[model samples]
Target: MTQFAAEMIGTFFIILLGNGVVANVVLNGTKGNNGGWIVITTGWALAVFVGVVIAAPFSGAHLNPAVTLALAMAQKFSWAKVPLFILAQFTGAMLGAVAVWLVYKDHFLKTPDKGLKSAAFFTSPAIRNNSSNFFSEVLGTFVLIFVIFYFTNAEMGNDKTPIGLGSLGAIPVAFLVWAIGLSLGGTTGYAINPARDLGPRIMHALLPINGKGSSEWNYSWIPVAGPLVGSALAALLYLWLRI
Candidate 1:
């Protein structure tokens, strides 16, 4: 696969499995329904592994736009390719979310909790404090990107692509995500990626599901803005450390 197509396919499975787990846990009457937080977190970690392993050979599996931006800022990725990668990630996320919706259509109709339906699509704050929520996302992404910077002895691939934990294999990164989800995800569900949250949330708005309720556009900016800010900070800090 080409780089763009690899990115799209990578992110497609990322959201497909990630959101599929949420739907399994929260939507009504599924076999995995009510599986609780550990199941959700574990599933997302595995989802990351699946996406990375598939896309790493071609696109380096950035999957998250924040990761792409951080690599660009760190001079590990070309600015020219940033937009293309991000577009693929967003498109993949949307398509994956649509798949989730279609698979869970019956459960969605049976489930009356609008919040639960929304939870399957995007993250929301447990406490709803804007500043706190933003900080939560930023902090979670900081851990993700910062630790990623030190994942292996090398940082960038030969052609200036961001080679993430892929160089070291997918297991370490999977554990990293599992750690983030278990430790820091409680507050804002640890979106840590602009495309991951925004694209699916957009689908939630457009999809014709019964009792799907509010898209929560008012708080949508936090996941995007916070992850960007955190990734930038991680890049800058990593650069300074190198100096």
Candidate 2:
């Protein structure tokens, strides 16, 4: 597959299963209903594993814009390709969000709670403090990108041959994500990836779901900006450490 196609398809699966779990848990009357936070976190980690397995060969599976940005800053990926990769990630995420809505349409209608419906689509701060919410996202993503730097370090040389996780590499990454969710996700839902949140948030606004309520545009920037900032910091630190 072409890199763009690989990225798009990979991220599609990420959201397909990631958000899919949320819908199954939060939306009404599903088999996985009330499966709880562990289920959601596990689903998301597995979703990352699946996406990485699919895209690692062709695209390196930089499935999140934050990841793409970090690699470029760290000189592990091409600056010229950043925009294309990010576009594919966002496109895939939006498509995946639509797929989740379609799969859970009946439950969405039955749920009746607008916030619950929104929860299935994107992250929201549990406490609604903008500063804390931003800090939570930053710290969560800092851990993500920072650890990813070390994960790739052994294989990454001057040529940067394997810039992202391989199929086996997905295992550690999955555990890393799961750990982040279990430890730090409570604050802002740990939207450590920008495309993972914003693309779906946009879809939540556009799609016609019953009682889906406000998309919370006011709080939307935190997820996007926080991860990007976190990524930059991680990349800079990695570079400094190497020097």
TM-score of each: 0.97, 0.96
Least well predicted 10-residue stretch by lDDT in candidate 2 = 153-162
- Which candidate leads the pack in TM-score? 1
* Tens digit per residue, CA lDDT, model 2, 60-153: 7789998889889988888999999999999999999999999999999899999999998999998999999999999999888888886555
Worst 10 residues of 1 by lDDT: 159-168
Candidate 2 lDDT (Cα, 0 to 1): 0.89
Q: What is the C-alpha RMSD of each candidate to the true structure, in Å?
A: 1.2, 1.6
Number of clashing pairs per prediction, in order: 0, 0
